[model samples]
Target: MRRPVAVAGAAAALLVALTGCSLGTADAVPGAVRVPTGPAVTPLPIPEVEPSGSAAAVTDPFRRAADGTALPVLERTPGAVFADVTQADLCGPRYSAGVRGERASDAEEAAAAYGVEDSSPYTTDHLVPISLGGSNEVSNLWPQPKEGAFAAAAKDTLEAHLRGLVCQGAVPLETARQALVQDWRAAYDTYTARPLATPSPTAAPTGGDGGVVSGGVCATDGEVVRSPEKQVRLTCRPDAEGVLRWQRRA
Candidate 1:
């Protein structure tokens, strides 16, 4: 049992077994962390973007009204744009080129400028209002919203106020036109100090033929007339001063 040769062989085998175990250290450990190979990675940064309809999102610089309703076609001549609209001017019968059919076409064309489909919600409105010496030229027109603070009814009130101011010499004619064309809704709130009261559009029957002025069918029926001449057929209502002011019946 104590043979030297046998002991030497046993010791050699044990050394070989120990050398074979050196590979076990290269294996992955159960909970050990490993360093990544190649280049280190970094997270990409996020970018901020503005909303499509943000306050400054509007690209059309010319839509300048408080509610973005002031789009003009720009047809004012020096004499025409700034002219004074006296009683004589308002009394002059409207110079119409065609009929209501033509006006509907015109309204369609006007609405197209604002990218608005279905012109039913809008009326072809004047930028420099005709009441304050604005012309019928296309440049003076825009599609006015039918109801709300920026509605035609509200704009009409503003027009009446400006007209009165012009007539009273409280405001210059050019000043009123410029103010309105610049921002009518602003002028409305500033001048009126209140929101525009949009009245329910009076729906009246169309087509009546009689003397337009004296005992006209529209006048008797108290209905608004869509005259073939394309005029704003108006009726006069007396004010507290006993002076008559013309207005649309509906």
Candidate 2:
């Protein structure tokens, strides 16, 4: 959360000129909406890549005890833990494995590698999700339990944030989201059994029409304003320019 939410163009001008909308239901904008469409499905073998240095090698690998050999989950830390079990399985355990779903073939490979009974409990998961721009690589993946892939919401939220950032012209939203997810996964591994405090919601922003607001998303050159009742609106005030935009939070 330290990094600013991709408030594209004129961070300063928008900060002063633009105002936040009240936390209320706005008329839904159909066309103005942009949602994440999963990562590119690439069917390629994960190359043999190590984390850079031996120090990193000793760090989080995100792998579980392979064949009961105590494979740590250090390397698998992605930027975020947004995806649920289903999403992780789609991306595979290693970031590099381009395979999705219950790869019986992968199971066979694991069975051969570990001499396990049927690879039944093992499945792939992406330390970084495709929607977030993570590459399909072995270093970025790890075979987790079928039941442990329940991090879907985290993935969804991160992906949504990335798209909003893209609309604003900040970092390639996809790339940032992927990095963030992978980072979160790594952190989760370190803190898996530890106790952490929950975060409190921040105060909501306030401003705009008696509160009946609409779409106000950011674009490359200017703002695109659409009526809340119809399409998503992007309003670029003379001063605010490209930075200010709004959409009703679901």
Candidate 3:
């Protein structure tokens, strides 16, 4: 049975206030200060996934690289969702601002599962985003690289697009969740008209550019950085010469 939307909305908002984290635009609460908690510890247990093509084979949800490290191994991180989450609760104005609570330990665990020793270049992302009722369970987490053809930023675009569709009643919430869990990149291709080669604006902007200014050279593509003054948000994208520069997000 579906949960009461009013109750769900209240609970979500309380959770966000307690955690100091949000799924909505970072600038949602003006004058809010964010403290940096350093990266997670190294040397965690790496979860093993069943071999592909075996009788009990687990189908991968994301397209993988040659080394099979680009995306999450399905057996280890199949994704999970919250119970009794209704469309009304998700579409509520407070939903995004109220959803977020992925722990540091969970991030470490996800990195270890991916055989990633250094998780600096990755964001421990929710396979099913919290805005869409994704749980904080380890199974719903994956270490998504911040840069690549279908990187974390690109996935963020898909998430936003899917959420918009669901909220607009163009797509059902369950269908959107299933699509994300099945194969996010494919879902992105089907639901969004944007090209994969293009760098999409991230759902949230973070600070700390290491002194990178707007239009300055940045280290990674699809990286978003806010100005030191906390005024303008910039994203790193390749130019005509394939040089990555921090440009104002479109």
Candidate 4:
């Protein structure tokens, strides 16, 4: 009876070892069933990732014109001028004529920069007029509405008027340039209030000595006049005596 018990125990141990080997090699068999020895596993979910190049990630740095004229953002389109450009070049007959070519690419680029979807109603315009020494650079380019109050057509008229003023020595070139950059709408209002008139030899004096005079007593402070000799412009400012006199612009 003792011997039978010991042999039986040895046989039981051998059977347990064979079962462990079979479990390890189960997947290697042609036809085999895998038995789970532990609880089922639940896989963790994968995190969703946002696309790096999505349009929603981009921030638009442009805004509408201050006076709601559908113009470019003032901060971005502060206006730029060519350093080498002179009054003579700007006032020449062939200066602005035929100077610009097809700007389709520039228009597309400006539209993209300003976050414009449909650019059909917009035209890429210079903040300052090319006829007035404005540059062709991107900094001076902006999408101006083709139609609206104070639109591209209105600006064109202002440009022509300002060019005339600069050529006539009535307004300084720098003053016209600054006026356009500061507020084109206001400049238009101020300059266009009166119809443009040609200066006459017998024109009445404007608080000056008599005719077009420079470097002499003047009536109004902050008044500008051109010399009859060389056509050099001068401004009326206060002197040591607190009297307004035509002086060379500093």
* Most TM-score-accurate candidate: 3
Output the lDDT of residue 243, model 2: 28
lDDT of 2 by residue, 1-250 (tens): 6446555435755754554433353556658877877644432222233344435334433342222222324423222322332333323333324434434564354334334455556555444545444444444444544543434333333344443344344444444443443344443333222221211212223235322243233322222345445454544221111123344333
lDDT of 2 at 189: 38
The digit string of per-residue lDDT tens for model 3 on 1-250 reads 4569888989999989987888574545777788985323222123343445634224434446344435566677777777767788887755656666888998898878767788788888988888787877888899888987778878886776677667666778888887777667777778765322323234223335554666566655566767887568787654432344567864
Report the candidate with higher TM-score, 2 versus 3: 3
lDDT of 1 by residue, 110-186 (tens): 66766777778777776666565565544455676686656787777677656555544456666777677655677
The RMSD of every model to the true structure, in order and in angstroms, is: 25.9, 27.3, 19.0, 24.4
lDDT of 3: 0.67
Report every candidate's CA lDDT.
0.50, 0.38, 0.67, 0.63
Candidate 3 root-mean-square deviation in Å: 19.0
Residue 172, candidate 1: alpha-carbon lDDT? 69
Cα displacement (angstroms), candidate 2, residue 117, comes to 7.6
List the candidate 1 regions with Cα displacement exceeding 4 Å. 1-102, 193-250
Q: State the RMSD for candidate 4.
A: 24.4
Ranking by lDDT: 3, 4, 1, 2
TM-score on alpha carbons, each prediction: 0.46, 0.28, 0.54, 0.52
The window of 10 residues in a row where model 3 has the poorest summed lDDT is 38-47
